[model samples]
Target: MFFALSKVLGFFALPSNLMISIGLVGALALFAGWVRLGGALLVISVLTLAVLGLSPLGNILLLVLEDRFPKPAENDNRPVAGIVVLGGSFDTIVAGARGEVALNESAERLTVIAELAKRYPEARIVFSGGQGTLFYSGATEAQVAARMFESFGIAPERITLEDRSRNTRENAVFSRDLVNPGAGERWLLVTSAYHMPRSVGCFRAAGFPVDAFPVDYRTRGYEDMTRPFRSVGEGLRRVDIAVREWVGLFVYRITGYTDALVPAPL
Candidate 1:
């Protein structure tokens, strides 16, 4: 239910939603109360529309968020105990239940997982996900992740499954319960670079020492911030994703699901 609640709360967290709501309230007042209030609402909405259309506000938002979290590679010389793979849009599909796989825009995690399988054959592989659905499906997400590994020739004998997690916090908590991580057992956490902060935070919060190995780097721009942000749609999409993760982080902290302020070791 935390999962469902968080998803619902995210809708209210959008800047667009706030703009629309103000316009809506102004319209409602015009019908029952004041004409001036309605006019003010219309004015505000028009100004917002003009600003969003003319500027790279979305890119600026995404660019700033990406800058806030720096995911530099660690310069450590230590053998990892095991590799923990986090789930995302990477494996969500109609074929997920039937052992079929399709790639998200960034298929880096899947390829990186394959590399981990080859490099550390003896280290246990843990797959974490749940049946995060409002519709019927024959299998859990963990099953889908497992089958993808099967296609890559990973032995079923070496796989550990935690099929009841709906997000990163649960991914860490449930997988920890399944794997029983030992002290000094270093782990390489594989996920998109943009998502590394929350994933790493969740795992460490749940008592797992994971080295962040971020892939699928998304934020990029010219050294000159003055360059035109021509791709407003793409910029908006990135901003949306960044906003969602940040809201998720704050929500997790408030309910004690995570400590968002804790400086995550990136």
Candidate 2:
């Protein structure tokens, strides 16, 4: 719901949208003879909106934001319990109407979970996430992940699941409640590299300290960055996500969600 609302906010709240609304409102206000500055405001708003609406300039701003976000790391320590993978994309976590499951980006995330689960058969492999927009019927994400794991031959008893969470915050809280870890006991938090900081912060806020095992990095290695004339669209997307996370770290820290906001283990 928040994601949808953000899309709407980003769209209708654009300067163009605001200018259109203002123009209409200003015209309405003129009948009351109090439209002195209103007309000027409308003109400025329109001009500003026009430029922002057409150009891909926000993409440049996104690049700056991306640079400001923390770096994500690939760590070596294995948790006592296995990793808890956060479902971010439909490929990572989604269900068909008839309840079929699919695994996308089966790399540093789902595949890694499977590998670890196979290697550490005794460890508890918890699946996180509840039903998202596709299934409003109230199924949790963990439920879906468990089923997927089951198809791969892991027993129901081996997998612990917390599917009641509606968002990443809930994902951490609910998982923490299930794991019920003591001080100094570690659990690994697995999610997209772009999403690790927020995931770690949320879990830390809930009082569970999980080592971040960042995967599915969208940003390529330095060799990839060496290419000049990188597409602005992709760069802007990375920037937008990184910027949001940079802000997310600050917000989580200020709200007391995390005790520390350490960057990627460089």
Candidate 3:
């Protein structure tokens, strides 16, 4: 139920979608003779879009989430018992239709996992993700990930696909049960940088102790705020991603799905 509701709410929560909705309301008001109210709402929606797409607000908002968890040091040689890579990296629908693995903006999550697999040859690799879309019955993210992993030369026996989870909470619970790590075993959680906070919190709440391995960074740094908007579409998209992540943290915390609103590295 939460998964379905989250998806529905997420669409309406996007900056672009919200603006369109508000504009539509305004248009309806105008047609009904509420000229003043219609004009006000129209202006508000346009201004909202302008601010989100042209100003530094979107970049700053994204930076806050991306900076919440820094990437691990290059030479930190921590022994990883297992590696858990969350989904949202593959275009499962397209992959299923085209018979090819297609990656999305979050492809870094999977790419980083591949590299880590080579470095930590003994570590078990677990891909936790199921069908997250609504009404689209295609290949699961885990199935595509398995094909990708094999193409990268990762042994079939080394990969464990927890393909039943549809959200981050499920990802943690399902992956933990699938891996069933013994005492003192350390697992590394890999996902987009902006999503690491909630991901880590969920894992901790599920009694799965894993180090954060954030990838797919969207922001360059704080300096990105100084640069002009390269593309209004891209800026608005980033704002949507940031807002969705923030909402996820809030909802997960309130629902007791995570240990913290913003999980910190230990």
TM-score: which candidate is best?
3
Task: Tell me the alpha-carbon RMSD of every candidate.
Answer: 3.7, 6.3, 1.2
In model 2, the worst 10-residue window by lDDT is: 64-73
What is the Cα-based lDDT of residue 146 in candidate 2?
A: 70
Clash count per candidate: 0, 4, 0
In order, the Cα lDDT scores of the candidates are: 0.68, 0.61, 0.89
Model 3 local distance difference test score: 0.89
Candidate 2 to truth, TM: 0.64
Residue-wise C-alpha lDDT for candidate 3, range 1-266, written one tens digit per residue: 86788899989988889997999999999999999999999999988887787777777877887888877799989888999999999888898899888899999999887789999999999999998898687789999999999889999999999999989999999998888988899888899888999999999999999888888888789899876577777778878888888888999999999999898887
Candidate 2 off by > 4 Å? 1-79, 91-98, 102-108, 132-139, 223-236, 261-266
Kindly list the per-residue Cα lDDT of model 1 for residues 1-266, writing each as its tens digit: 75676666666676556567788888898997799989899789767644553455555544543444454344544576788887764446565544567556667776777877777777778877776654455466677677788888998888887888877888989888888888878777777776777777787788876877777766565342343445544544555666676777776677666656433554
Q: Provide the global lDDT of candidate 1 against the true structure.
A: 0.68
Candidate that beats the other on TM-score, 1 or 3, i.e. the better one: 3
